[model samples]
Target: MCSPEMSRSSDVDVRRTETRHEATHVKARRPGKGGACGHMALCHWALVAAMLCGPARTQRPPGIPGRTAENDVPLQTAAWLAEGRITAIHLPKERPRRLYFTLPKKTSAFSVTVVPCDVPVEWSLMVRTAEDEPPKQQRTYKKSMPEVWWGNSRKNIKVYSNVGNAVDTYRGPAYAPASIYVVKLQSREHSTKVSVYLQEGAGLPKVFPELPPDPQVRVVGVGMSSVTLRWPSSPSVPKVHQSNTSLQYCVLVNLKHNYRGLCAALEALRRDKKIEEVKRQGATLWPTPKAWKQQLGPHRKDVVFPAPVPDGPPELPCVCQGVENTCTVSELQPDTLYYLDVFLLDSSSGSSAAYTGTSARTHQEARPTGTALRDSKPRWVALAPHGGRLLSFRPRGWPPRALLTMQVCSPHQVRVTASGQTQVLAAEIVAEEPVQIWLQGSPSYLIYLENESPATVAEEAIVKIQASSAYHRQAPVLPPLRTVKSYSKLKTCNSVTVGWHGTEERNLYCVYHQQLDSQGGPTGLEQCLGPESRSDTERAVCKYFQDLNPQEAVSTATIGGLEPGTAYLFDVYMVRRFGIAIKYHSKIVRTKKDC
Candidate 1:
């Protein structure tokens, strides 16, 4: 008997041959006639032929159902076939069967698998572009193989060979919607049953709902250093989940003085190029001024005034819940234009959309311009004897030679005293119904209102003071020359050391500073002195003078809590014993960028 031998032929026909019967069949002993066993051989050959050529049936593999035809279709026609469906194909002994399929819109990737049932037949697969006519051969594979193809267009595709119970996946290039694809299967054997699965990209959204539009915003009020914003509630769109319940809003206030120029430059760039292209350039798009030394070289000798510092954390947006729909943003610069952007936030998705709001400018505070004497309330003091009260008047922002007209109305007798340069000018009591006095060169004066009348008389009195120029309409005296000799600044990352020299002996020296913009103009006043009192400006000046020695000449004050990489203008003034500013000096310095 002959033994079965393995065949290495690539053709599928090699596995099915009549030589196996000749090798495994046993010979029967004939009767004594010794005739040839050709008849028995003929019977056995007929049975083997019947078993191989009879009606062929194949069972479906596990996890896959349905049957697919073995017919060839036009490549363009198959491009529209539904995806994710298993199609069965019968391998023929002749030409390959071409199955055309189409990828859905926005299909990023695709996969194809071929599972062979019954016999493992040698098959070839080729992926081709969809065409009106028959597609030309691009890639070919032999034997049972699974493969996936990827391309931007349906022009040329990938191919695989010898696929069995294996899946091939490919991530196609980004293609337009509804591109065509085709798969060709060919084998050297007939009646080979194979299942093919085509799955498009996953994670594609089946249904999408519309989102609500942005809410309309309005500016309710704008104060000197704060702004109040209000917005209407947003309604959810149809077919979308209601987001109003979980919605939140935030107010983004931009210091317009600092960003307006940059925003204008960006707008010009947008006019020249696309906004996306301009954004790609990043920070380069914003116009940055020259270095501080270069920009302020010409104006270095000019005097700079002390500016007000910002109060709280800068750049912190004001946030409010959706239900309130209103928010107040504070700690803003006065007399400054500010741009406001309101955004609606979705808590569930963590998404935000901007609202339309108009820009606003804060009102400037009431301040003295130049050489103007403004009237202010008197400082009340409790004096000894009969619980009497004294009214203290400090002629702030008044010229040294300008006289002040003082009027006092008290039920009891009133005594007025004026002093200057460590000497009393006058001290006298008036018995008239209203007392009046004219005084000059007195930094400050005190009025002693004594309750010397009957006990029924009240202890309170009324005092009114006005500048002599206001009543006489005469030109006021020019301010006295400043006592500051020289000034210098030493700046660190977050602190500044200011040292100055005074020429004359005075009451005290006070230092004030404010933040400056790129152009050396004051952005706001920075309070390095201390917390403000009832009379903020007066208290600041008083605290500085009172804290220092009265006769100190060389003074150095360090101001901390300053922002890094910022420029500031420091002013030093020598105040007289009566609160008169005799001399003043200013210097500009920039802090270090890093510690």
Candidate 2:
């Protein structure tokens, strides 16, 4: 990232460079239909040349001594440009041009863009409010079909690239109460024609509307390393006025400040960033009120904003069952104090509300092995000496394998699948004696058993089974064996339109954006953007999600806001039942150079 001071210096250097390349361009005369420009066209270009650089040819204006184009220089260095007009300006190599605009209102915002005629452009479009220059430096990319790179600094907001960035656009706040803003185009090594489109409007982010009320959250239960929480899925709003806006949830724990205070502080921090951006880029045409600025932040130097929760466990997830707002935070330390917070986020914009949270402590590391009677008892069955019985194995909902431990109340023969794999040991049908069996699968698995032969057995065969599972023991569920596939629909400099194929007909699939590191790819979980990514760069954004059941097989989304010449990973995840996002497929796409 280039600093503001360095970017401003680069803007100032355009002045000295422009003078060395000062020259006039005239249309060559071609005798044909709609022929070359006439004398009127020469005068018009001469006028524009007079306003920008170079001298206009005058017929010595009736004895005006030495007032000829031969020695006369341009009368003006900079010209007055107004809004609501499109101007096509030509910049000579190493030369730059500056145009000034007068804002109609004191609080008007400004927008400017340059449309280059050809590729591999070296000219930059810079807009400086309350200053005199164009700009360059750090680049942020966003695009349509033609990719555009933009730069923001303390002095100006510029739409340009150093080498080959097709940055011809900028819309941002102008300096407040200042009537004049400067637009300049600087060219390096190449002369080019760029059409400048300009506009003005209100572009500041400082609206203080009423925020919705917070949610009420409570601790549902606590385990040694996990805590279950429940709260209202949404705020209690009137049915007639209730919105269908989807909300995102984030839980913060182990903070120095209380949940409410920390939430307020975060809000203040966001406003502070907005204020800084506005002031730095001249993004506000009006100054923030003194009281508003003072009230916008915590305003305490001693109060430190803590870093994000460290790399210990998985991110806290808010999974909704139905209308029940319940979630479990697992993989926590036992016997540790925790300060919990649940933030209800409404939109991609960082606006959120932190509900009041209840602090809960986890159980100690060491506890008695067993004491109280079991809430559920395994059913014991008596079998005839030669009888065969088929028993079902219950699944542990959260685990990949449904595991059951069997204790032989009496000698018995048993056979069951292990870890979804077939491992037969001491099977009465295959072997002879009845031993123990372990079965695993989801929903449930079937355990095959038979009483010992009459020659080896005497009394009836008995067995007891035990297992641990999620809160509910459900019937087995068979996941689709098919695969999800992704392909590029269109590729551009700063965006990639992608489509997916071959997903389960009944599955819901979501696409996620992952910006890869420049070298090869992300090295660890800290840098990945998949569902398991803990990186801050992995935003809580779902670009495209669809129920493939009712929709067409191909769903596409043009993912923008990507950097030029960078690679990105797009992941397609199938949302299995119970809100589990199982990654089905991933595609690595690299964008072209914006030039």
Candidate 3:
């Protein structure tokens, strides 16, 4: 990155270097139609004399008193313009023959132009009129087919390079006013070689300034039935001279004080037009005062109020749901007196107004009660195992097994007795929240039912199981298979770890071992191998489980100490806490003898 100081110096150097050179080509003119000036038109003697003289031959140029040849001093190069040197002299079509010139390259960088008549532009400064002018600067860039360079406005101006060879025609004024402007060719590698050209009378005609923008207006707020309007903040401008450069604004408002009155008026207009589209939708919209109030929000003071809620419902239930912004009113007799309030909201004006109207009505029949629970499906009561405590009963009717309605309705310990049988189930009721009671069987079948009424005596509304042994059937369950992995063999002995996984929620594991005869039948399997081989070891058995390698799989037990080349029978069983156990026997594996 270039340092700020270096950058500034480079900028100044490009515009102010004192190298001056003579114009390379002699001046010549090419005339077209009448009053048409060509690229080198100033070179014509007649035009040159016309530019230097006053039309009436009476008024002199602003600075000259006596016409002297000294005023025609040799013109300076664009770079030497800052030392108070004239680059070119411009002539007015109608005259006092005004003259205009600008510092050369300095003018090229901006939208600067020198008009022969010297009145300053409005809303912008006139450089000549200001005494504190800063030193001018220029920046140079390498030329390309489509040359993109920054102008004085800091906006890029595209100059087409392919148009002319060695000679570039500038379609637009290169900023400054002058009959001649000059630029030098710096060598390809920054070598200070120089060249010059006189480019006076080479620009197109100038254009005028554009028109101003439209004003901003808005509807800032809207209520249930009203609206507010506003406009953006604008700066005040004072009337000035004869320049077409000023702006102005205006405001207006319309209001419909009462909502009913507005709605009625709208309805009346709609009827006169016979417009079906003007009819209200299926539901009548009678917005409540509260709804209108809420719609106005904090800006309520600036809006029109809406009509109040109508008085009536099927039964005018103590509690009811109302329309979004509206409130509900109850307890008025048929044909009672009521008033409606409407508001007008003008957010733009920051103002509001309310209007009121009266109305009367008659009542209608009451509505039906809403549904709470459906009755098509059988309600789930409870599911439990046999021999476990029966928690509670529901509906308190005959058969008494269907409905699961009662959740923590009574203590879990509650019991009912009937027909010489005492109900043994109890429930635990938790306070504040819903609780559940699971039922279990006691060796018999039972049916569930409900009754509309219950008997006062224990004999009435009685709940009883139809069968005494309805709860004893064993639930269908599967036994687990025994598994052994990571087997190892040593001299005369084989070892393996045993374990199992089961789906039965009540299953437990038990390991067993035995020897097989030649016929593959167990032989003397019950013989004691000491407590080390004991499966029922709660009484006494091995002290510690065998050590396993890090790479070994995890299992329940490690079995060792087998006869070399002998087949063995190993089995594991799944046992339930209160039921029978099933064994899952494993295939025999012979031991290897190498020791």
Candidate 4:
């Protein structure tokens, strides 16, 4: 039951047919016929014939063509993709279906959403529109669209492609007078069914007509699970567009299509029995990041981004609302492409003015919560009472060497360690003086800044690193990190106050305390909570003072109702939307005993 328009689903795990295996029977198109294969989960394409025997629903096994002029079902009524039959084994396969529909005349914008009923399948969509044949810098809005027949010549043809239904932009009044849209759906083994939605609305809305161009944005840096973005704080509004209402930038993050299939594929690979033994030992799926890289070689440039599953906490998802131009969206899926939209909104009128859209891919591995530097530049880092800063930079050439110049105030010392290196470097600075050091090259260097100033005082230092040749150096903004530092400041016969540093950017945290046994190990479940309130069950237990408590200081909490002269351990954990980081702090302290 294969049709002529199936592309590889990057999971090209070529194998002999197994029991009810999926994607085994996809129909691939002929090599010389269709368009270039996109680097995505492509499993469907349209096999359009130039003739129409009847109305729009009369779709027969038509020959291969791109867009035809007759009998397209006018995209009128709204349809819902719900109530699908579960795919069963031994069922006859369904051919990939292409539903052609023409947008109504005077159409401004619309969006397409295709969701699979069961197992995920990549669907294809194309809209034949017009794009400028001229260079982008010179291209400007003409009074009207060029007078040309659709699909008649190469200059007249510009196909907007939507690889999978993670929602294409609420874009386009369209390039030409009549933009014909077509959606290709695949019926693979598991249900081979997907619900397609065709409606008119803005997803990542195109710029409004006559509105001034939206303010521009720049990418500061991209880490594994976070993205740092900077845009203009006060984007100018035209006199006509400006009103009494204040304008602010609205930033929305949407998931991209590139990493969706790869996220799915790498998850399946993790279930292999061979990797099972190694899984229990650590954070990595394989023995090392290098070994994990080797396993994903079959996927080529894909499969590195492993999106946290069940589901990611929404992308429109996360509304990155800001009055200032800079913000970092954290807790994002690693190795995934994130579509970002920054627009100016008139808060009083509740209407949007100008906007810009862009996309960036996150790093494969989640980096620590610190100012991350990819370029060799100067950075000023503020030390939060024993906090650390990581200086990440590139080298000028092979056989590497890079120069670092650091300035620290009097009574402060800086401890520097190169991440992923054999040798470490450290230096101390005299008050009001600058120090210079040469660092061995690596992707990043971890440097901890410490000051002899009072604990309540925070210090800022100027650091400049020269890796590659550069004309001008820019400063870095270091985000905070959760160190293993903890303190038990106040204690009584029955209570004690404990605290640990929590990440200010990601504030969700949990602190747990349990009484330790004579050997300093966690005692039985019952004795852990209380000597009097013992547990009847034999399992060991750990109790948290605050579980995912957002409002509390989260960094510190007081525990009461404890046994006298008892030894207890306190631990701090940073809670994330998908999962929690490693135990940041675990220390044992003694409760004071009454005379």
Candidate 5:
């Protein structure tokens, strides 16, 4: 007689096969073959029949092969299998098996793949939730047999079969975090074996480990629309412990409406004397913990809880990662107080560390209405060759000190004098350009510009002057160069053509080239060429052009002395007034292998 476990396994197979045969009215039979069980005696068949006809069988249709009640045999339960275990089960003819397990609270999904042994077998799989509702059924093989082949030419040679395999995935409604799930496996005819592989959770930890100690965090800057935060680098840990680990950050913003509501609710909860009654009424209004740090156990000390925002709403933070030690949050309300909490996440182990909270208030928007610096447009001044133009005006409601700005609108050798002073405040004798001068002690001033060029007096030129409060002083603005192009039209093995437009003044233009590695990082063969050179190699590689006309906007330079069959990156920039460098464009070029 078969043992209780063996009997139950056979019974499960009988019920499943009977159900399938009843629906299709077809029976699957295995031919007598020479293999593992080919030499079994008649007693073996008798034992299988007895197991199928035992009390476990329930009344069913006359033509069906197995008892219906056999499907109810209690399943073996086990804890979640660890990451690398290959669980297997042996199923005899007509028997089915069931397994129950629980998923971790952080587990989002689970998957299982069933690989059958070398035999002809039909299998059916069903997954049900805790509620016992069978939402779907997955079948691996239907009316099919494993592929068979003979290993040798001799008839006595061994035969091989390719067992069927199928993968079933459970997600969302089929399985939930921290919920119970059931998986049932049943085989139709022939006694066979199967190996089950399961992957639980979405490959992430449900709970993170504690953070290391003494983390420092601070607010670096605040503005009307944004706040900048900074923190020290995470402490270094052993590679074995931190491999595959990454960090992510989150920031929560409490809207104005929610903030006010939470503050009022907390105050009311504090004043209520009957704690039980308040609790019974659902004290959901209580604030959440100040930060995730409070959730860590007492053993961790490096992290500190952020103080709750005073009279402000509970925090709803926002998060970002990848900005080493510094992160900026924008799109904030003007003149508002904000509480920020920053945290660190270890992705591999699902561990997190948080910094102490910091708070800052944004400044009110600046209003420049009614100020002398507002709406001041550039005024045009004409100068004849070797002649000068003078203008005097008092700026009303001006600051004690103001910024006087002047730009030559046309090509001219211009000299500027202020307040009748003999000293020349600014001159652009070499090239027409913009100039800024600081004026103090008086709001009224005389300004004069003369065409000091040796050209004849018949030639005419134009200049524009703009004066404003020093608070309005802004960096010089220049139009960006566009349509940057790089090519090797000459097909030279060691040269490339770099061209661009939009040069507004006699500013110094430079082309920098560097050999780059496969990852685009510099390989230390960096070289720069321009109108000015600070090194011997730069002087040898660069060509100088003097007194370039602004109207001659288009410029191109040919760079040589490059190695054959090499990749190089090039960028161009201009040094504007006051020595401000502005990058215009960049490109990559690869040289031909041979000339």
Candidate 6:
């Protein structure tokens, strides 16, 4: 039943076997031709050779001569083999192939290409030294590639690929014998192609330039919640580079609402209050003070200053340091709610802007309205000497005075006692007549009195004599206690200049100065500075701004050495000549640059 093709394949296999047997037999019969074990070893070799040649892929056997299984294989299977020419051999049993190749001195990263022959099969690749040890592994691709596959290229290896459909190809990194490195590539595909080369190096990147700086402006006249703003010309602006820009300043209060409008409205209110006058020039009816008069609302002659208005009166200068000058407001009642606003007139803007801040209420004290006094009965009188005593008074009449006499109906012998002494004097009633008598005592004095009533009778009365009572002449009342008002200036690197002003400078000329924090608020830090505290040569009482705090901003400061312009706080006091000393007030001052 065997076909012709199957029969031919068997015949060829049989003849090849018979030829191997006859050759072995001939070698065994010959004396010197056989191997050490004679024809028996030769027959074993012949049978192995026969089997390898019988329609199967041949693999190497052990102990072979002139052929080895370790060195014979396609480039795809032995990718680690170096770059130059290669020699290969095959053995029947132990190993299928052996490979050898020369390597170049230098190389770069490389890759491999592969083309499969016959059946597609999965394979792994590895490399190592011929002598010993496990092989080093390279890259491994998990998925299958096409018959003609490409690999990662490297600098040194130009190109490598499968040579023919009959043999499998391998590819990998560049190899160098100097380093003895190995590369490997394997795939399940039938074929693949890979090229290796070196490209240019990566360079550094560029950077972005920086932006311009922020503009700056000057700040001045800072107050509780706002600051006066002023700025120099913008350098970036054309032609107007050095010219000052006219700008309206705004106050940001708590980052909300525009306070500038409130300020402006207040200013407008002041402007409406400004009074202007027109006077005759020479013999003409022209305005004399041309610059003084402001235009009126309409068809009205130029309004005159001190002009009366519906608000009851004209503007009157509240003259300070002068008397008889009256300031009046018609609508003002006994106790009305009102506020005063101060203003500064700007000639250029013709605007009367309220002074940054100056408003206060009018005085609340009642004015005098002269009236008559009512009569009252005199109280009981004391007959004490008030002697050498300064605690009694004897009023003679309505407007009590020194020399006055009075008559009363009483006992002729009346007794008076004071300071442990008693005296009896005759009392009499005088009719419309005056008499003067000098009181006799340690502190002697005189008095005269007369009765205005007619037809009075003579009677005994106690003529009590005593000195004027010391009622109004009491211990001087002290003013409320206040913090000392002192100011300091930096004089030198080691000292500070102190200054103070007070009302009692005449009687109690001494001033106590102490350093305080910048806010003019107390620092609880103080030092004395007055005649008693100063050494010789310094005046007993220094000027308001000359002394220094020992532990001041400087050692011995003068005004000039302080920060060109800076604020400082100080405490000052006044020592009275006789009464208890007082700390007058505390103050703050900004040191001027030139001071």
* Highest-lDDT candidate: 5
Model 5, position 555, has a per-residue lDDT of 69
- My TM-score estimates for the predictions, one after another, are 0.25, 0.23, 0.17, 0.22, 0.22, 0.14
- Stretches of candidate 6 above 4 Å error? 1-474, 477-506, 512-520, 523-563, 593-595
lDDT string, candidate 1, 167-208, tens digits: 233334433333345465655544544556666765321111
Model 4, TM vs. native = 0.22
Global lDDT for candidate 5? 0.47
Q: lDDT score of model 3?
A: 0.29
Name the Cα RMSD for model 3.
Answer: 28.4
What tens-digit string does per-residue lDDT give for candidate 3 at 144-169? Answer: 11111112212222222221112122
Best by TM-score: 1
lDDT of each structure?
0.43, 0.45, 0.29, 0.42, 0.47, 0.28
Query: How does candidate 1 score on lDDT?
Result: 0.43
Q: Name the weakest run of 10 consecutive residues (lDDT summed) in model 3.
A: 116-125
Alpha-carbon runs more than 4 Å astray in model 3? 1-494, 502-508, 519-554
Report the C-alpha lDDT of model 4 over 1-595, residue by residue, as the tens digit.
3222212211121122221233332333334334446312233322322132133322332212212232121223212122111111211245555544455565566655453433445456555554534234322423112112222212323344444423233245544444345555654554333434455544532221123344556779898887877765443444453323244454545442212222222333443445433333212211112322343445423322323211212133223232446767676666777766565544333223334456788877644544555544445555555665555555545445454555443245555544534235545542333344555545445554544455665654323323332223322211133343434447787877766544334434555666778646432221112122333331123333332333442455667777888887765554333211224435677788882
- Candidate 2 lDDT, 1-595, residue by residue in tens: 2222222334234344344325322232434344555655766766675664323222111111122222212212335554556565666766556665545555456666554443334544444333322222211222111011111223455544443424345666655434235555666656655545566774322111112354567888998888888766554222343334334455555523444532343333343545544333211111111222233345432222222322222232432111235777666677766666665543322233456777787886652222121222344455677765655444444463332434344444533333222233223232221123333343444455456545566776554443434345443232343233334346777877766543423555556767777545332221112254434354324443434453344556677788888888766654534322344335678887764
Q: 4 or 6, which is superior by TM-score?
A: 4
Which pairs clash in the backbone of model 2?
Answer: 114-168, 173-282, 173-283, 176-285, 402-440, 402-441, 412-434, 413-434, 443-475, 443-476
Question: CA lDDT of 340 in candidate 1?
Answer: 67
Error of 3 at 62 (Å): 99
lDDT by residue (441-489, candidate 5, tens digit) is 6645556667876664365767656655443344344544434587557
- The window of 10 residues in a row where model 1 has the poorest summed lDDT is 57-66
